[model samples]
Target: MNKQQILRNRPVGVPDEKTWELIETEIPEVGDGEMLIRNKFISMDPAMRGWINDARSYIPPVKLDDVMRAGAVGEVMESKNDKFKKGDFVFGMGGVQQYKLTDGKGFYKVDPSMAPLETYTGTIGMPGMTAYFGLLDVGELKEGDVVLVSGAAGAVGSVVGQIAKIKNCTVIGIAGGPQKCNYIKKELGFDHAIDYKNENVRRKIHEYCPDGIDVYFDNVGGDILDHALTALKKKARVVICGAISQYNSTDGMKGPSNYMSLLVNGAKMEGFVIFHFADRYSEALQALGRWVAEGKIKTEETVIEGIENFRDTFLKLFSGDKRGKLVLKV
Candidate 1:
C-alpha cells in the first residue's frame, strides 16, 4: 500500500509538494473488531490546517512521520468486525492512504444507493453538518431574517446559504471572485453575493441586506467578518465555524475592529467546533439527505484526482481556487 507521510518538517507558509513524502508499504492485517478500508475518496478541509500545528485543540496534532490525517470514503476490503462486511462502503477519519485498518472508533457503513459515495464525505457529511448546527442551532436563525455568510461559495458556506434560503431568509454570500459569487446567487438560490475582491463588502452588505443581518455565518473570519459585523440588526447572532483567513497569518491574527457592533446591536458571537455535535451527526445527515432528495438543496464538490496531489489540492482552499467542497479521488 502506498501512503503519504508528513516528512520531518512543518510548513511555514503553504504546504508545498516537498512537504509530503510518498512511500510504499506492506498492507497490514485487520485485528479483532477491526476492518481494512480501501480508500476511494479523501476529504480536504480548512480545519486540517489546525491539526498540523502543535497546539491544544479538540484533537491532537499529527506526529512527525505519521500518515497525513484526513477523512475518506472507502470500501471494506477485509474485515473481522461483526458490524461490517466485505465490500461495504464506509466513511471515517482514515488518513491520506490507500488503505486503512480501523478499530471502529469512528467508522460508519455507507449505503451506496442512498447517494454517491463521494457526497457522503462532503455535503451530506461533515461540511453539511457544520452548516446545519452552526447556522440554525448556534446562530438561532429565524424566518424572514437577513443572513450573511463568509467563504460563501465553499463547502460549508454554500450549504449554509441554501439552507438559509430554505428557511425563508434573504441570504447574501461573500466570496472572492465573480464566478464564485454568481454561482452562489444564480445556482445556489442565494438572494445576493458579494465578491469581496472587487466590491466594498460593507456597502454591498447594506444594499443587499437592507433590513440588516440578523444572522452571520462566519467561515472566513478576518476582514470579511469585520465588514459583516458592521451591518447587524439588534439581537443578531454570529456563528463562528472557521477563520480560514487567519490560519496562515505570520504576524498573528488581528482582532476585529468592528466587534463593538456586537455590543451596540446587543448581538452575540460564539465559536464552535463541529466535533462537539458528533452525537447528532446522524440527525443532521438524515435531514440534509431528505432536503437533497426534495430538491431543496444542491451540493457541489470539487474533486482532485490522486492522493499525490494532496499538498496542492489542500492549498486550494486558502487560495480561493476551488469552487465547492474540495476532495481528493484517491
Candidate 2:
C-alpha cells in the first residue's frame, strides 16, 4: 500500500492540519511506456505554497483531493519504458506520495555515487540551478560588485554567496538568527552577515554597502525587498527568486513602497522560473559539480524522518525551524 498526502483546501494563511488529508491505497501499477518509482526523499520548497493557490501563475495549481506537488528522488521499481530500467535512480515532480507512475518525460537519471541522493534535491539540484542562473544571468552580477542576498542561510542563498565570492565580488547576507548569520560569515565566507531579527535591516545594509548595492538577490520579500530597493546603485539588477515572507499572507502581496528607487537609479528587477533555462542546466551543473568537488562551495541539508510529518515539516520553511535545504526522508 502507498500512503499519500492530499491537498484538502486552499489555505488562507499558513497551512494547518485541516489543509491536508493522509490516506493509504494500493501501489499504482506500471503501464505500457511508463515506469513506477518508490520515492525515497521529498523536496520541500517555499514554491509549494504558490502551487496550491488558485490564483493564476506559471504553473497550474494542484487540484483538490489530489496528491500534493513536490520534487522527489526515487528508485525505479518497475519499468515498461526502454529509457529507464529497474533499480535506476530518478528525479522529477513525483508529488508527496510513496509511489509515482510516469512516462519518463521530465524525469532524469541521477548518479548517487557523485554525491548523496539528497544533495540532488538541494545544492546539486533545483536550488543550485536557481542560484546559478538567477545570480549570473538575471542579476547580471559582475566582478568587484557589491551583492546582497536575502535568505542567505538557505539552500539557494548559501550557494549564491559562495558563487559571488568565487567571482571576486563583495557579498553581504541577511538572515534571521545570530547562528545563521555567523554560519554565513564564518563558515560560508560571506563578506558580511546581517541578523535581521536583531538589527535594523535598512541601516545595516547602508553600513555594509556605503557605495550602494550593485545586485540584490531576494528570497524573502516584503520589507527586505523595500530596503534593497532603497539601496540600489545605478543600473543595479534585482533578481526576484522567491518571496517567502508574503507566501501565506491573507492580504495579497505587498508591493515594495520604495520601488521608485528603481527608476531613480536606472535599475532593473526581473522574476524568473528555473525551468526557463532548462536547456542550459548542464552548463550550470558542470560548474557547480566542479566547485563542490574542489571544496569551493559547500552544501547543507536539514532532513526530517517520516512521511507522516509532511505538514509539520513543510511549515518549517515559514517558521525558520531549520536551516539550509529542507528535505523529507521517507
Candidate 3:
C-alpha cells in the first residue's frame, strides 16, 4: 500500500487538517517504460500554499483530490526505463507520498554520495537553482555590490547570501531571531545579519548599507522589501524570489509602498519562476556542487520523520520553528 497525501480542500489563510487527506492506496505494478519510486524524502516549502489556491499563477494549481505538489528525492525500487535502472536514486516532483509510479518524465538521477538526499531538495535543487539564477541573472549582480537578502537563513536566501559573498560582494542578511541571525553571519559567512525580531530593521539596514544597496534578493517580501527599497542605490536591482511573509496573508499581499524609491533611484525589481531557467539547471548544479565541495557553500536542512506527520511538519514553514530547508523523511 502507498500512503499519499492529497489536497482535500483549498485553504484560505493557513491550511488546517481538513485541507489535506492521507489515504492508503494499492501500489501499482510497474508497467513497460515505467518505474516505481520508494520515496525517501519530501520537500516542505512555502510555495505549497500557493499551489493549492484556486487561482491563476506561474504554474497550474494542484487540482482538488490530486496528490499535493512537492519536490522529493527517492530511490527507484523498480524500473523498466532505459535511462534509469533499479536502485538508482532520483529527484523529481514526486509529491507528498510514500511511493511514486512515474514514466520517468521530469526526473533526474541524483548522486546521494555527493550530498545527502535531502540536500537535493535544498542546496542543489529548485531552491538553489532559484537563488543562483535570481541573483546573478535577474539581479544583474556585480562584484563588490552591496547585496541584501531577506530570509537569509532559509533554503533559498542562505544560498543567495553565500553566492553574493563568493562574487566578492558585501552581503547583508535579514532573518528573524538571534539564533538565525547568528547562524547567517557566523556560520554562513554573511557580512552582517539583521535580527528583524529585535532590531530596528530600517535603521539596521541603513547602518549596514550606508553606501546604498546595489542588489536586493527578496525571499520574505513585506516590510523588509520596503526597507530594502528605501536603501536602494542608483541603478540597483531587486530580485523577487518568494514572498513567504505574504504567502498566507488573510487580508491581502502587502506590496512595497516604498516602490517609488525605485523610480527615484533609477532601480528595477523583477520576479522570476525557477522553471524559466530549466534549460540551464545542469550548469547551476555543477557550480553549486563545486561550491559545496570547496566548502564555499554549506547546506542547512531540518529533517523530520514520518509522512503521517506531514501536516505538523509543514506548519513549521510558517511558524518560524524550523531552520534552513525543511524536509520530511518517509
What's model 3's overall lDDT? 0.94
State the lDDT of candidate 2 residue by residue for 74-142, as single tens digits: 999999999999999999999998999999998999999998999989888999999999999999989
Error of 1 at 181 (Å): 1.2
The 10-residue segment of model 1 with minimum total lDDT is 1-10
Candidate 3: tens digits of C-alpha lDDT, residues 1-330: 999999989988999999999999999899999999999999998999899999899999999999998999999999999999999999999999999999999999999899999999999998898899999999999999999999889899999999999999999999989999999999999999999899999999999999899999999888889888889999999999988999999999999999999999999999999999999999999999999999999999999999999989999988878889999999
Least accurate stretch of 10 residues (summed lDDT) in model 2? 315-324
Per-residue lDDT over 130-223 for candidate 1, one digit per residue giving the tens place of the 0 to 100 score: 9999998999989988899999999999999989999998898999989998899899999888999999888999998877899999998888
lDDT of 1 at 55: 77
User: How far off is model 3, as Cα RMSD?
Assistant: 0.8
The CA lDDT at 141 in model 2 is 87
lDDT of 3 at 293: 90
Q: What lDDT is reached at residue 40 by model 3?
A: 97
TM-score of model 3 (CA atoms): 0.99
lDDT scores of the candidates, listed in order: 0.88, 0.94, 0.94
Error of 1 at 234 (Å): 0.4
